[model samples]
Target: MNKIFAKQFNKRALAFGWGMVMAMIIFMSTAWFAFTTTNQKISAEITSLSILEDYYKEQDRLIAYSETSSKLALSQSFYQLAKDSAIDITNSCKVINNVMVWNNNCHPNADFVKQKFLEYYDTNFNSFMLEYPNKMDITYTNVLENTTLISRASPVTFSSEKQGTFAKYNFTYNFEPSIKINLTEQGISLEDFESIYNKILECNKKIECFQKINLENWDISTESQGSWFLFKLKTKKPFIFYENDIENYAPIELNFIIEL
Candidate 1:
């Protein structure tokens, strides 16, 4: 009896030991799976945030580029229009007084030249604006009289030939005639500037791109390169987005007679 009882107790103890070992194996497997799943989740979240960061940076870059490009296009149009008006005034003067005169202006010429230019400014600018509504969007505003400058050629006297030979020939000449016209004013209409600005800002996601185009925001100057007009249009953007700000500028050089 004593031997049978000891064998039975030993069998029960072995079964209990096997059961504990199986339970331990299951617990370890479950713990490892939970750890791996948690790690994967963390990695996925990191990747998603990185992608978002890159997207925002690209958006900001695109916003700046669009603004710069649009302003440049508009500035070139303005330069061409103004330059053409000035050139037309210059083209009207070919003085018939004394062919030997280098700069002749005795035909009552330059006064009418300004008047003709005013007419061209009104007609051509209106036509151009009407044709390219989305490109430049500028209207024919009144020219600033105070800013308009006209430099007319003074009337020249006949330079007669003193060489008293060869049947005493008489001739006339005009050499390299020129006139200077300088016009200074805010060319873009303030009322119409908002629509133009909004068009430029359409590429931005959330960065505040609305800027008021006041005189204080502009620094414009025109330099003459021979007969061409070089316009430098500048503006400062006073918005800050976490230490990223780009200065916008457009430099346009246009020869009056050329299509550029």
Candidate 2:
């Protein structure tokens, strides 16, 4: 009886040991599978986040390039327009008596020139809008009397002094064949200027021409440079995303002086 009892107890103990070993193996397999799945999910999320970061970086780079390119294009176009207008105005002058003259005056008609400039600018602006669809505005100002006239006269040296000798060169003063009528008041209309200019041109061939022009309100002077006009161009336009304040998101503008 003692021997049978020992054998049974040994068999029971052996069976219980095997059951515990199988349970441990199952638990270890489940834990390892859960850890691997969690690790893979976390790695996938990290990769997705990295891709998003790269996409945003690329977008920022493209936006910066676009803004820089747009500003350069607008600046070039605006300057070219102003330059063309000035050149056209200068071309209207004719050389008379070694000086440039416009309609018997030292400069072109300011009002007329401004009108033509506006017309040409407006026409070209229609085409410019096709490339850059922005509400652009331009302000132009001109000083007609500030124009420089081109002359054909060479520099003349009249006198020179040395250590022991003083020499005087005989130079003939070739007066300009044209006369300029200066009015002090700025209230004169363009018509008044045209009429006065015609009268002055007509008087150049007559003796005692001062009496003919009725110089009670006008002054007389010789024709010279600084009687023409120069203009300024100012252009402004809004940004693509102007609703919010961003760096360099202010209104774009270009300003320049246009000289003929």
Candidate 3:
């Protein structure tokens, strides 16, 4: 009986030891699984952050490029040439109108009128060409139909309560002229033109700057003049003579009319 009891006790102790060993193995396996899962999650988050950083960096580069392109386009020689030409034409028209009305006293002779117009053209047009020598294929056409004259009146205040009216002698004679601008030999390519136009649009934020302008109702032919574009503009505006405040107000509503 004693031997049998001893054997039963040893068997129970072995079974308990085996159960503890199994429990320890299970706990270690669970801890290892949890650690691996957490590590993988951290690695995935780090990778995602890296991807986002790269994306934003690329976006910044693109934005910088876009801005640079826009600025370059606005500063292009072609754009400057167009703007300067327009300003010159407008100023020349105003000068000629003033000369015809004030200098000749509205009774300009044929020779006087022709000479004044020629002088104004030579001075301004020549200056423009000299500045932009690369721009070739310039054609000028002057059409004289019936001279259309414009007149205006100014209100005169007599006293503190009474109002008076006086006639201010001002006139604008209408003339149609066709102008052609060519850039075929300016070392400019179609791709460059397109890029410049695109950049202009981006900077201006509107299509108005790129739209076609007509000074008067004249037939404009761009292709016939070997120009990239051609248009007819009417030269007309009010001529005002101010002796005292000549710089304050000289010519009003002067339009040199340009088509491009």
How far residue 52's Cα lies from its native spot in candidate 2, in Å, is 2.1
TM-score of each: 0.35, 0.34, 0.31
The window of 10 residues in a row where model 1 has the poorest summed lDDT is: 251-260
- Candidates ranked, most accurate by lDDT first: 2, 1, 3
All models: lDDT?
0.37, 0.38, 0.34
Clashing pairs in 3: none
State the TM-score for model 1.
Answer: 0.35
- Candidate order by TM-score, decreasing, is 1, 2, 3
What lDDT score goes with residue 70 in model 3? 24
Q: What lDDT score goes with residue 52 in model 3? A: 55
Candidate 2 C-alpha lDDT tens digits along 188-253: 222333454456457553434623345332343332224332222122332322223333333332
- 246 Cα displacement, candidate 1 (Å): 21
Q: Which stretches of candidate 3 lie over 4 Å from their true place?
A: 75-260
Best by TM-score: 1
lDDT of 3 at 159: 16
The predicted structure with the larger lDDT, 1 or 2, is 2
Q: Taking the tens digit of each residue's C-alpha lDDT, what string does model 1 give over 1-260? A: 99999999899999999989999999999998888777766665565456556545544543344333333333433443333322333455332221111122312233443454445445543443344323422222334244343222223222233232223433333221122223333343222223322332352422122122234444444343343223334433322111123332443222211101
Candidate 3 differs from the real structure by a C-alpha RMSD in angstroms, to one decimal, of 27.9
Q: What is candidate 3's lDDT per residue for 1-260, written digit by digit as tens?
A: 99999999999999989999999999999999888877766665565566556545544543344333222222232233222222333333323322211111222134433334334433434343334323323333222222311111122111112111222222222222222222222222223222333333343423244344232312222222221122222113222222342322212221121122
Give RMSD to native, each candidate: 30.1, 27.5, 27.9
| Model 3: how far residue 152 lies from native, Å | 48
